[model samples]
Target: MNFIQKEFRHILRDTRTLIIMFGIPIVQILLFGYVISTEVKNAGIAILDLSKDQATIKITEKLTASGYFKIIKNLNSFDEIEEAFKQGNVKEVVIFEINFDKNLENFNSANVQLIADATDANTANIIVFYTSSIIQNYVNEQNKTIKMPFEIKIDERMLYNEELKSSFMFVPGIMAIILMLISAMMTSISIAREKELGTMEVLLVSPLKPVQIILGKVTPYFILSLINAVSILAVGYFVFDVPVTGSLILLMAETMLFILLALSLGIFISTVAKTQQFAMMLSMFALMLPTMLLSGFVFPIENMPVWLQVICQVMPPKWFIIIIRNIMLKGTGLLYIWKETLILFIFTAFFILLSVKKFKIRLE
Candidate 1:
């Protein structure tokens, strides 16, 4: 306990450690959550209303009122759409054919053209989807007033993320990656630095048991990791509008379990690495790459090769991401995430046991 206090005092005195431990998490969360969103809000679009009819006007009003699109240009000619696209301000162009209302009245169908700037395929796709859905809803409402032959209806619903906000997906993944990087990488480097500076030998010679020394070394990082988790959650919630739909207590508990797993992995790395640089290299290759790539952070695990899927199943971050997404997005209870929680607990115990065995071997 005294040794833990000494370690805490030492960490408090180190300004650089304090800043890196706390400041980086806040900055990274704000940058990723607020600045890098994929949600389409007030997207610029051009409208070519060839028929100056009430139907087209009503549809235009509905589109604008939906809050997903902004009509920046009312193009007089079909040629203007390419210019709007080239200008880079418009993501999509909606063109109503001549006699749009006449076609609907006589033939019960009208042609409407939607041209999207496919330069950014994903954003363009989303813009087109929103526009089409709005138009379809308007058509459905109109059909209710007057019976129409050969009616076609398509209904699309997005689950978990009704708004289709990328922040909803990115926030939990960022939390997992950042927590793993800070806890595992930082702890490994700190311990390796002690070895490099010959402090480990002195600590071994002290009255403190090996387990106590190890616990003391990791206790401060555990607390800092908890603070970081709360800070990231707060930033994600307040700034980016990411919600913890499930129990907040459950979320924090899972976060702490993941942190312990990361710290154990860090301790194991420190045991193998004699220098800070080597520990950092190990942590990067071992933790960061897998966390970012295989843990379903930026990509889906099911999309990977069969062997890669098998490999990612073993990654702690992969499970942590699943747990977080289930809690935050799906609003699932502990029942839904208990399997993942158990996997993380198992990983933490395995890493801790392996690290203890390694430490004992080193002492012997």
Candidate 2:
């Protein structure tokens, strides 16, 4: 009893330890409740209503009102349909055939083509199922009063990933998670180990700029992380059959940028942590979990709450994952992923600046 009371008091005295023990778990559970949603909400879609008749309008309304899908655009032409998916916002395009109402009225059947961006296969399946169900329900309701039973024959076309292989999604995400963990955690621990052993003070006394010191510390990790990235991509391609549909060089370049960002993040963390264990813990809590959960690795970003989605946007891994998926799965190029690339660049710059600032402050 006495030992238990003493242990409690000792644990309470270290606020950082207390936060790690109690605060993180509580926050994690609360956040997981919000972050771990599988049901997609407001997934962006386009409706190509060629007939633009009353039935099509009502069906569109039914889809929107279901709170699962949002019509981002009423696509004008078939050309726009492909571009819409490439733009990355439109997950599914619901197309109503020409004279859809007339066909349904006269022949008791109409064809509705569901074109889904199936890079994220699970979400695409859900969207197709939900949209099909709503259309079927509408048909069933119409059949109640009519002499002939109406039917909406839904033809699903899954673009990008026709086979709907889970590897197409997991490969890119695994790349993001692996790179973030290896780069950030290793770099942080390396620097923190130097600090713990009193070697960092020797380096500090040397005639080197803070930026130079940071770059020197990270250069080896940077090279090793790049190697890790390439190896992962190679394994994904050879073992998992993940395609490098886009420029392989571009993918490697983007990966290098993400690795640099992770390294800079590691430097920033080491600036605060006095020991390697603290640095490792900080890296796991701050970088690893967020990369796994919030970066849309295991879960769809659209499914998470709006506030949580905001957090995802700021996470460097989210952008990197998007870039990786686009290049590998969607065959998209830099024109498609420049914004994500720029975001990563900005994050890298921010962390490097923050690391330098913290080092300067400590030096004083």
Candidate 3:
């Protein structure tokens, strides 16, 4: 009874430990409940209507009233569509040909092209589908204008995110957070454990350099993180049917790069913290929180505030999450994500250099 009471008192005194044991689970649950919704809403769209007719205005008003879309621009010509898409706000572009009203009255088939930005393929697909449904409803209402011998039907196709499965949305984010948590928090604490038990002093006295010791500590954890990544991917594919649409080898290689970067960051944190408790706190604050919040795991980056958006760029997990989503969902190749890959590589190199420098300074 005395021993149990003493343990309870000890835990009550440690606020950080208490927060980890109690606060984090509650916060994560709340986040999943409120922020992790798959239901898309208020997708931005643009209209390039060369035909400035009453029918065009009516269809546009109907699309706006559907609550699924908002028209940001009433573009004049075809040239402005490229700029609107590049701005990233407009997810879908609806183009009506010059003689759309006349064609519908005489020819029974009005030409319309729905161009979607496939960067975030899932959102793009949803916008495409909802927009097509809105257009079809308008067409059905307008079909009373003339008695046509032939009827034209619309078949909408989702280019990138064909299935619109939640797994495709979740897998990359889960892999990023899980790998970063394991590689950073666990590795940092384990490295600090050596120092806590005086094993690090013995190793320092031996022939091994400090860099070698850090590598020895992180290498096992890095390999384990990679295995866990692969395991999660397998679960996503076999259980959830999230297909790897791009080059699997490239995905694996990019994942390895992120793991190495996270492991080096862990070692760097371990070098700064003298004890395991401090190491754990630093890892949680620096690695886990950033990975979860800034990495677009729960919230969309597009909706974040300007300052947070800038901060997100520095987070390695953010870039990796984008890369994985592009590769797995959009079937994008290196040419598409080379810039983000370069950012990850740069972060990994920086972490390695900083860890090496910190290890040397600690030894002296």
The candidate maximizing lDDT is: 1
Q: Is candidate 1 or candidate 2 better by TM-score?
A: 1
lDDT of 2 at 67: 93
Top TM-score hit: 1
Compose the digit string of candidate 1's lDDT tens values, residues 1-364.
7877877887789898778778777887777655445458899988999997988899899999999989999999977777888898888888888888888888888877777776554466567777888988988898788967423222333322233333235778878878888888888888888888988878777776768878988898898889889888888888877788999999999999999999999999999898999999999999999998998776667667999999999999989999999899889999998999999999999999999878743444
TM-score of each: 0.74, 0.57, 0.59
Quantify all predictions' global Cα lDDT against the true fold: 0.81, 0.79, 0.75
lDDT of 2 by residue, 70-170 (tens): 88999988889988998899999999999999998888889999999888777787678778999988988888998878788999999976755342246
Model 2 TM-score is 0.57
Candidate 1: where is the Cα deviation over 4 Å? 38-42, 46-59, 62-68, 72-168, 361-364
Tell me how candidate 1 scores on lDDT. Answer: 0.81
Name the regions of candidate 2 deviating beyond 4 angstroms.
1-154, 157-168, 360-364
Question: Ten-residue segment with the worst summed lDDT in candidate 1?
Answer: 152-161
Q: How does residue 157 of candidate 2 score in lDDT? A: 91
